[model samples]
Target: MTRIGFRLALAYRSNIIMTCVALVAQVFLLRMIWTSVYGSRPAAAGLTLDALLAYLTLANLQAFVTHTIVSRIIHDRIRTGMVFFDLARPVGYLRQMAGFQAGNTLGGLLLLAPVIPVVLLVGSITVPVNGAGYVITLVLGYVIAVQLALLISLIGFWTMEIGAVSLLYRLVSQFFAGTMVPLAFFPGFLGVVAEILPFKYMGYVPAAVYVGHISDISGPVVVELAWIAGLWGLLVLTWSRAHRRVVIQGG
Candidate 1:
């Protein structure tokens, strides 16, 4: 195996196990929160006990699956001059990184495979998703998540602060994408804003669509496609510029 492949495999396997541990812990904590919240006033007009539990489970799973903090990849490489090796290689640097990310995602999915069934069995939870929707939205969100991470990593060519930047991005994404909590809990104005952004499609919209909370899937699908197109276009532009910048800067 290539050094990059092996390194990614090792990291991905370790991180995914860690991710499952974290996910289980978070789910239990959320269950406690759900108990407290439902203890006082059980149901809202739209949200229910089942819906609430459903929301918590989906939120945890999607957040765990889709979250990527790889901006550090480039920052680490660049600071250590490991990026020089990437630049000298015959293959396109973007292709190399894409392969690495794919392997990472594969390992992540692998880790989740066992943990997910165990969580459901122990917690007595059934997902809001089915076979076909699961396959489609899972793939879509996975691609979106990876592309987003890549776009952020590309920022390293200009900024060394990608670590801090990615932290900030995750924080904001929680609020905007409704990953911190579902947008259904948000007040009217904030909910409106969340609906408009592509962030929701990445986490809430897809999950909800698969789970059947989202009645109108067509609109979100269109918007998601637009965002994917925009992101891919941006990725191409940024990759080209980053490559050119590195060649010219001689670092």
Candidate 2:
């Protein structure tokens, strides 16, 4: 399944190129904006321009790598009455989705490789202060991302057409996950809100760990794990219940 997913990802050459181009442009423009914002001001919210750049670079990379294609895959299956065939396969639906997401992540990383050097050259990115902690957080972040995406994809079972819900999820995730801006930079109320949300653990915490903004990694990691456990159960339950309500669109 993983091999199949990998091959499918590799097949999308044009999509990968366009995605890389868009991400590069976004990172470049953000660097300019942050640089201008911090001109002659050493730091704001304890983040220097260089650190901010590093954070943004990693956040964007993580966002790209962890972005989900599962919703569309599931949606198409349901639409074409293919999900019934898929559900009957021995592999099981959730694991099948995971394999595909894993493959997509790997393919995205390949697409992301070119942008890393470019971002590094153009912006000052920090090295991880606690190497092991950073790695742990990063791996957990991917797990959290996949789990969240799985939950979203399962919503198609209820909503039938999940495009709007998926879009809403993306926007909410981007904001709360700190992909758009660091949670620390948000207004006081929103900052507090972001802190309480699991989204921050996905992109921001890992990037912050690498850049030395987050020194105590245990708290965030534990919270992220808890979310993963809870979400995993939710996915299983949703899948079971959704199957009961599923209506095959056609033969």
Candidate 3:
């Protein structure tokens, strides 16, 4: 690995540790609240207890997996002009980011997955079964989440202060994406609205899979893929626009 790669890997290790700790704490807290409130209630209007627990776990993981302040990475680079060097590199800008993500994800699985099940076992909650639909939906969720972050990061092309933008992403993601609570809890009309928005694909639709709600997942998948395709187009378009304005240092 290059020096930068090594450095990023070190940072990735720290993220993995912190993420695992956060997941553990949050899961226990959620279990406490859920047990108290869901004593015997259906997971959500009609979801089974087993399904709810699984959804809870998967949703928690999804939150961490997608949890990142991406705008800062690009904003800081832009402000300091370090990204100038990136412009001249042989590899594409987005490819560099994909490398970092690959490393971070690899490091995260070491801690996040191995310890999570053990912690869940303490609650004696039934682990969510990985049905074919559940697995496919969740995999799709991961892809959309990465796209969401990339979309946010690309905003640095036009905005200097991405803090507010990133915060906006988090707010919408937490509430609308079903990370904080399932969309099923929302009013029916509101839930239907959430269903159509691409944001829900970030966490909600996948959690639905964990709960076996994918009687039909085609629509959700189509929506998510459309967002992915659209966002990638936007990212490329922004890059093309920025290429004109960006001051290349070494070129």
Candidate number with greatest TM-score: 2
lDDT of 1 at 22: 81
Task: Answer with 1 or 3, whichever has the higher lDDT.
Answer: 1
In model 3, which residue pairs have backbone atoms overlapping below 3 Å?
A: none
Q: In candidate 3, what are the lDDT values of residues 1-251, reduced to their tens digit?
A: 13344355456676667767777777777767777878867655777666666666667777776665345666788777787777779988877765555555555554566776765664344534546766677667666666667667777766656778888878887778887677877888988888777767767777776566656778777776777788788877877766655645221
> lDDT of all predictions, in order shown?
0.71, 0.82, 0.68
The lDDT leader among the candidates is: 2
Mind sharing the TM-score for model 1? 0.87
Ranking by TM-score: 2, 1, 3
Candidate 1 lDDT over 106-179, as tens digits, reads 66666688898766653346655454655566567667777788888888888755778788878777667666
The superposed Cα distance between candidate 3 and the true structure at residue 187, in angstroms, equals 1.6
| Candidate 3 accuracy as lDDT | 0.68
lDDT of 2 by residue, 1-251 (tens): 67767777789867988888888788888889988989999999999888888898878877777787877888888777788878889888899989888887787677667777876666566566778888898888788878888888888777778888889998898889898788889998999999887878778998899899999998987888888899889888988887666645332
What local lDDT does model 3 show for residue 112? 65
Cα deviation of 177, candidate 3, in Å = 1.5
Q: What TM-score, to 2 decimals, does candidate 3 have?
A: 0.84
Give the lDDT ranking, best first: 2, 1, 3
